[model samples]
Target chain A: MAEIELPAGIMPDYRQQLPKFLKDYAGRWIGHAEVRPGVLKHWADDGQTCYTVRILLPPNGLLSAATVRRLAGWIRKYALTGRRTCRQSFELVGVAPDKIEELIAEVKASGLVVGGTGATWHQIKCCTSFVHCQNAAIDAPSIAKVLSDMLLALEEQKFPAPLKISVGGCPNQCGGGTDADIGITGVFRDPPQVDEEKLLAANEDIGLLISWCPTAAIRPKPLPEGMAVEINPARCVRCSSCAQVAPGGVSMGRERGAALSVGGQGGNSRGGPQMGAVIFPFLPAEPPDYALLKERVHSIIAYWLHEARPGEKIGSLAKRLGWGRFLAGVGVEDIESLIDDYYPARTVRRNLHFKF
Target chain B: MKAEWQELPLCRQLMQGLYPSHVAELSQTRYPLQMYEEGLKKGVSAYDYGGYISIPEIPSGAGVRTSRRPDILPESPYLRVLGPAGGWLSADTLERLADCAEKYGNGLIHLANGGTIELYAAREKLVPLVRELNSFGLDVGSTGDDLRCLTSCCGPARCDLALVDAPALATYLGQRFIDDQQYPGFPQKCKSAVAGCPNDCIRAMMQKDHSFIGVFRDLPVINNEEFKSWLAEGGDPERLVNGCPEKALKWDGHELFLDGDTCVRCMFCINNCPAIRPGRERGVAWVVGGKYGHRGPQGPMVGYVLVPFIPLTGEEGFVYLGDIFAAFLELWSEHGRRKERIGDFVARFGPRRILRALGLKAEPQILLWPKNNAFANKQGRRGGEGNGGN
Candidate 1:
């Protein structure tokens, strides 16, 4: 056996190595304003201004080695940089005021858009999809790409409020889809199919599988030679918990689609942080061009643009007008899935004290 | 050592429109593309969701598990390196990371939505990779049922609207909870985040189990000169007036006034008009029980405002915040069930109980709807009060 030389695990202090302007104005930043749509100017108390130029990355946030090297080279050539954003966008900090245009043009030449500032449509973010994660019900990246391409122009325009969108490969929502203004989550309709042979072969713990099911959908079924688990389809919410616990034993069915949700906002500006309510519970996960999905998104955006007050986010607007009115405004039919069935007593009003 | 490669048609089709296609990126690495191609052929995923190596002989091996431990690490086990707070990486660091990825298991790197850098590697190579990463100020963890990395918005370092140093706070917390980040002792994964201000660009409130949001306790100060200059520079007064959610701002042509009591400290004014700056008295609000996972009885939920205001004087403020975090983790670990997330645990015990346990008072900020008891039942059980019971 060879001895492994382990180095001391200490993360470097990024503040020490920050770009010149940022290091100089680390704590002296007083105020900031959007110089333009994608460009920003941060003012220090000493009257020094630091400029930042934001650019959109690919929806899935996947960068090849070559592209990463190229970005690193640009960072060195332009202004030295700092932190990138949480969203699917990259920020180059400490850009000179005189060189802002040149940097934007150079970035554009590399085939990336400079936008996602102010009140405009932000870059769409999606999960790893089936590319890496096995739990993905739909190819989320493809869907996100199609939507992002169509909505690229909106990134440059000033909207009523900042809008963000996310796509989750599954309801697990690794991409925080439900936290976005418009959330698209993949969902499976039916319960998992139990393979008794595989379950026995794999020596899976039937108890673990049964316990993993949130709705108690799995039950121990004794066979002549071995024991297996059975899924109660009626009780299953299709959360993929059982399948995750016992992969080869409990598997999800093929009836899969996407769920469209709206009115979600992460900020505490108006209605505070709230998850998007599922509007269209099930939409087909069509590939290449998701016409039906695009149509619904367009309609929702149109209604929001026409009806919302200036600087009002979708969630706050929904809160003011009521989800029902917003639904009707978008011409969506009220369905059973649209209602919060978790607690019937809470959601359903007993009296006729309703708005007509 | 040479890496094997395969051209996957189905993966290529799925990644057609994507820039720097993931498939193309993986194809240049040691990642097994045949699994993807075979899975695509079978209309399912090549990697097992249950973290088992895919069995080739079984028909629809979706249910065919292997002799691998189901606890952690998949077939092509990947290491999730905790990214710098707010995704801050130097150009040199980026080049090193890229080199590391190519030199080790695979050439491709995934900027995970959870604010981590994921790189695929074989089980045997994990040790050497971690050692290498450690040499360059990087470490791998955030796997299994442990404390995940604390992600924060780029605060005062980048954004001017920041009320507190969000990245600094996150880094402080991360350092304090380093042991938790490395060990998998918790009942379930605990995620945390810090937002610079009310404009939570990181979506911390709805995505993390515990979130600290930078907030101002006082009224927004108006710079009269800046205001006039902004107006002179074609700033829309109508839009600013109309955009106020609380109607707290009023302009009588000669002067612009703000109703202090009406303002909720939402930061809308500060964000829209540069003249309006956040009040000096700033601190972080502790919000707990937020999660995006649709698991357990209480599905997805936004966190409750546990503490409306925790005055942050300096580095000592981090100690106060850390105290609350440690207390909550202890409470959850003691009472929570196996595989139960903090959000579900909080839901079962009720926010009132949680506040009481933490020795905190319930403020009006904690209430989503004031004086609304529609969700309460005759038994006095609050909404979201039961465990696996509707």
Candidate 2:
């Protein structure tokens, strides 16, 4: 729980902590309170504000007055439209002398707890969920707010390397979470199951309604006394097809749970679709209960975090290892159903998985 | 109408003026021997497809596809085959091709996709020798930036999971394009493809600027009409579900359902379940950007989802798809450059931006998400497949 203070300067790098020009503004009062302690806002000579935070937290989470004064100088001089709140340039300088490293380390490890800083993501933020948005399929922000501390806890140390993670309220992939390293997109696994006899009694066109499933998961079947219906678990990817059909369809039986796939990318910023790969078939865990997702992600990615050569993107590991070796090395007895491994049995029979 | 070649009388001697000989549907011995006997009957050798298509044959040589500079061809040579690829030399055919190279033209070989080997010879020299080479089981064809030999990954006999008749499709497309290789007023020598599946082991995605990947929609549905038949037919629902990596399928007793959302439209389920049946969604997602290593950003590429679902079974569908791609090029060629990859060109003048400029719908769905590994765990967008392995 060591705290580290960041040096201040706003050039390309913000690590210039003890600068020559701001050496004089170290111990002064900007408004009423002492610029050096407690809860006080200190404005640089240029009228740009900096926060001289006195932290009772970790090294990565604390800041000091000197750092604030130094940062304020640049913000006032160079920050474009600094008055706009979304675009504020306050520094966490004059940390309580007890927790600077802890503060900086947190920034390095958990992007959420540390907030946005140089080269790191702005924050592990989110929007309201089903309780909030009419269309939200899962509880997004609650999961975000709940897991926020733990997610940030890891940021207390330098990561194997920094990567972006985001979450969304629905399949729309909004908030740019689909492009992030760890994106939690909420979706319904068990769509509304239709009660055929009841629906027909209500004058619903079950035959035509069956055609609407994207995976063609619905089909009309004969029932005993009246015409009951059947649901296709094979073709249903829990995309609300049944719900859309029944409207109040089955309430999706709690939460049909989640499916985890990997390999999505916006290409290398250059170009390339980079479609994701399937790592887990389906995990029966409900949203707001992201403990499962977090734990699984930790295990599956542990090898990546622990074994990957420094600076190697997780994507490259799959390519270099070749899909077969990658699956076997990770003890994944089977992965054919993942990203369409159409490679025949003998084609890559070098491994035990292919006996032919 | 004779099927054999040795019966023709005389072919080469028929060239009274410019005609060299006849190579098509010969009547036993090539009529050339008789034509030659009737005096030096000589005319420039003609061909079947093009009027007097010349095959100015040259002496054999080893270096073909290896040479970068285009060697000047002899007058009247309509086509050429260019290179040393995967052991083009069978020992006998090697020397003859090389001798032609040394005596007739540049000592080079043209590497070809259809496995044709050649050196550039004078256009005039092509006509006469084309027939002679054909007699020796060799034929001359047009070789330029436009015409590429459409091919496959050998086939299941030598490969695996060659579900579709890949060789036949490739041959069809190749022969079809060969006739129109110069006909289509393409933005550039447009590329077309016929890959068997996603493995695309042939690297067809990277080679041709455009390609067709085979996909089959076989995820099971709880259609007792179908599922009962499948299960009654001894179909194990467990095996089917186990077969799908995406877990797009599951069996809850008598009910069989297709996890449609998880399915990528691959034909595995269909291949596995004969009773499950395949739907009209049986074709490829025509991707526009899959090139690799030209200016190298791993060759910035993305296989766009153009023509979402097509029936690879019908001629109307094939022709319709052809027109779809053709129509796209008709518009794209107006803005593209010689060096720009189709995707780059599309991005520069994005589908939306271009549509607006051209009064189109600005379709953004064409943006293809290429397969990448680096960011899969963090940004991967699949179910049960994200880094969180089930």
Candidate 3:
């Protein structure tokens, strides 16, 4: 009579158990257990909350879900087994398209969301940086992690159009950072502003040091004034070219960061498929200093999202919009301060009817 | 109000959705389609040339979902069609699609990249409507990804830059291979586009999975006397020689001498020279994998030269290209992964791998021509010898 009958389809207070569930999963033999079913899942591996997912294959078949999730995930999971925070992807082998929705519901109920779809750049990929590659001129891994965090939100939201970004430590692109709407690479902004004391104290061997340059950009000298070696700076491609050959060859300018290039693609449109061009000389974006980089990327994305057609690539937009318009629109008044004119020696693209 | 897509009610949408099959399940449901039809019949067509639409502005969101309308019910009977280039046209097809909208249904034909005609119809009328359009040789369906219309260059009629006649090959091959104009299981969708001349006016460089373009080996020697007469009668020699990217031509006042080896045979000069001609021994050049979209380690690129196989004149040639493509499909579908276009598919196992997978030998002749950077001279040459090749 007191309406005690409707046993209250009350809110089942379940969120309170999240902490208990977390504690139980830790240090327990909850082996291969998935909280939610199919695709997305929240799991505890070695007592840490980890995100696991199932990727759907394209209509073209072959994929369990969509893309490099399994590929990128396998790289992170097996290759980076000890890391506390990890994202893992599993291929859903034999699932039908109609079942995707059903699996999505089960996964969402358990918590984690799927990765890389619609507008987001595929994944944050990095190659062995300066520590491993002979061709590496700078530290690419540090810059990659910085970029990954800087553009994390860009991964989930749908855009008026899709956008991509990449970062390369050296001229050889280890990180796809430079190919995106924005890119960053390591390079010196000026003649390595050296402390004369720092060079001499390092037992500078100028000859063997300079030999490390592929571009022969550095030249040593016996100067009367006290400047032992001066760099051409023009030929320097910002790879530890001179530093590896000569001791104290250069300090990464007075300030060190990464050089940025944009719109690298291999295509036969507007501009023939070619390497990305440098947009910023060097920005001091180590870890905490990503504010400027974030602002620069956000401004660019906001403009591009409004302007670009669905298939219009970033390179064409960068080219057609020119450095002047691009910089000006983004309110980057100090173009040189933002980027170095490494292209001064390059000539106008005179597409000779014939190539020699 | 060309086909009042928005006016069609939910019930009529379901009707049109069911109308295009052998079984007429929607025959009993006609009231809703009739209601939408009455509203669409009210618009007036005042313009003749420019339809309040251009290539880019044409409706792209059609057939985006099960219904022609995306936000509407998932099973709306609306249908949107795709065609070559989406807007790829021979001023004739452009005019015809435009006319169909003006006269019968709403003159709204949206073009698609893969090439084919897609029609939007009301549920009640879709049965009779499809049959009516079929009389004109138009088929309604999707034309992206797997199902596409075989594309061809406008060919010799408009361009002076083509090395061979692309239109003819496209017409011939299109007629032979793509009869049903429907999807069949293979490595993605098979794209066939022909470039009449080597200049590839039809974008064969970045289209068709299997592209056949023209190439010339020998230099086109000028009939000096005839060339001089044309020059005297106002032909530009600089335009003719400069047309060649190789700068393979030297006009020695009396004659035009072509540097035979430098003749990448881009037809710039041949197209420009009134007295010049295509060499008699000329033939078609075959290429594969010319898609230009997205990138990984290897991104989208223009077609690579497969083999400068001898020109095929009739049905035999179509069979040659088809068989070669079939071999490629067998290898790629079996080996390639998702998001891999043909080039990436080939690059994955290696170009040699692709060739071996297709049981093909690496023909040196295939490497004879560089596929990209196929250029053309923008000179306005009226009429001349393009067929004369040696």
Candidate 4:
């Protein structure tokens, strides 16, 4: 075998770059306690303590160049080490307890919020809505902004447990919304539309489009001129696979809205991590205010606050009380769509276990 | 320099009120927001999603993937640069990263959900960009059918609840498997993550194929002094005592007592009550086959805990774990079908058979007891038994 020259870069050693205090207490942290909503105090074995201040970012982890430069300055000034969290937030590590107030002020002055820790609403992770992606059924970023604006105060409020929310433009779910406590995914009630002219002009492989449908909804039809594809409305799940395959040939239909799913979490602590189950299969995604989506989320959180045990995640509570009773508690009517009959083999109920 | 751009009325409306908006930030990027505006006008993606132009001449191991945007941009293949495993970056490095983003490719640097930073650049400029990134102490990888970036939470460096040094472990495994990260030789894309503890702040157990989770076997330790102080600071004892999922906590007036047998170490008590801390004995749990994609037969799945506990001894603690991981990857690449995700493969091919193939003994942790029916009563068997008849 010949020696291959790999990419010349090695990851910068964080130990050499991190703040002095963090380097000193690299693997010696004993325990931590939340000082306030966004402040955390960690103790080392030598009794030295350091505080961490968390700053929140908007959906999709977007940051302007100016904002990035300012954040870089903050990282250089307030605390030497900064980290981008998995949930689209930033943390200023190794802050002295006394300087936390100053850092928070600096962050706020720069049009940023400083709370995503403790039992409150975390950042709303949304995928690129109509801004960049062609698969967007609903204006996800606008709706997410509405939700974030309404729930901004709750970022400090102590709920029964922390709530994670995600929004997807289409069912492809580029945002991984199904893994969140409250997942809002764009759905198409109708099937896709096939353009005969575009289909013929693109010269797409008709067989490929016919086979790529997850539900086999797309089928070939012989027109007078050539071959085209037709979609079966009942059979179609509107997954956008055909649209992605032949961009000019096929596309999703106009009838679109958002679906609300509840009780999903990624943590192994409470219920060992499960995908959220759909409660409301369709809700009108009116941008700028998204009143329906906001109302549904508020209702679910209210029910959680009223019923859930102190540290019990909404998913764990739903699992304990059963989805039927949990949805009823949120004033939701049990409907056929909630049962998820899409995959009949995997979801059939066999036993007599009922929580209703 | 900012490019010519026009923010839509909807984008402007969304950008109004509260914290900064993703729309505003996106508009500032040099990714041709005008094309997006055109997309909104036409109700379809301005950029084509068709398969990338095949470039067979370039080496397969190069850190590049084809990306094409019809009518607006030329053939610009993107690069997937590995992010810092520990999620730490110096301020100077961040500035240089922005500079790099502006200098090469589109001005936008996409922080992908998989923890890789993506930038769009033409094929001709990829080698120079990789060299520049290398000089800045960053590398390009985590694309195609190979090992993805090993992401980890900020462990003992800043977090107090961390039981293991997550960043260290991630760095160790990442360096050992650097070849895997750079090469496109796997049956399909493989992702891995290391969570410092079971809190799973990084969400590896639900999303990654290979997840190394920090675990402890003993009950949480309670400090009476801290408990009294916490109560004095208005921490509700009733909430803390009743919130335990396992009901393992008991408050006998002055001190807190725990039921050792009943406690499952779910971190509920330790999370709510700062007075309580995790146990002494700590190690990493090797969980495999978790994924978030809706593709494949099994759909999304939570990884099965293959080995309940693997002790961390010293600086070279991950060597043994790396050996096990490498062997599993080799086994998977040989047997797995093309484009088949690991979770689906594991579900189709039983976990017991996988364990047997790897020459490992299954513990109770590896079993999915009762086999999807709540009424069945059966004991979970180790590997070698026919999945304990229910």
Best by lDDT: 1
Candidate 2 has a TM-score of 0.34
Q: What is the per-residue lDDT of model 3 for residues A144-190, given as tens digits with 9 covering 90 to 100?
A: 44444444545435553334455544433434343345666544445
Model 3, C-alpha of B343: deviation from truth (Å): 1.7
In candidate 1 chain B, where is summed lDDT lowest over 10 consecutive residues?
Answer: B58-67
Better of 1 and 4 by DockQ: 4
Q: Could you tell me the lDDT of residue A117 within candidate 3? A: 33
lDDT of 4 by residue, B33-54 (tens): 5555554554444554423232
Model 2 lDDT at residue A286: 42
Off by over 4 Å in 2: A1-356, B1-129, B132-143, B152-176, B179-189, B196-203, B216-245, B253-256, B268-277, B296-302, B352-390
Q: Which one wins by DockQ: 1 or 3?
A: 1
lDDT of 2 by residue, B1-390 (tens): 122224323322121111111111111121222221211111111110112231113221111211111231112122344211111122234345545544464333332223234344555555454544444434444333343334444222112234343444554455444443423344344445566555453444544566666555443333567667768867778867765556777778977677777765444465455444344345555556544212211222444545444456543355555555556665566666443446655555444443344333423434445445565322212332111111
Sliding window of 10 residues with minimal summed lDDT for model 4 chain A: A7-16
TM-score of each: 0.89, 0.34, 0.42, 0.87
lDDT of 3 at B155: 34
lDDT of 2 by residue, A1-356 (tens): 88775411110011112233323443222222223322234344355443433222111111122222322332333321111001111234433334434444543342212233322222332333331123345444334443443444453333443344444444433222334445555555555567555565655546545644545666667766555456777655554434534542222434534445444443221123354454564554443336786676555456566655543334555555665665554446655546432223422345465321
lDDT of 1 by residue, B217-307 (tens): 9999998888999999888877777777799999887668999989888877787788888998999999887888787777788887888
lDDT of 4 at B82: 81
Q: Which stretches of candidate 4 lie over 4 Å from their true place?
A: A1-13, A129-139, A153-156, A192-236, A239-254, A286-289, A302-312, A317-322, A329-331, A343-356, B1-7, B40-43, B50-77, B121-125, B370-390
Highest TM-score: which candidate? 1
Query: What are the Cα lDDT values of the candidates?
Result: 0.75, 0.40, 0.43, 0.74
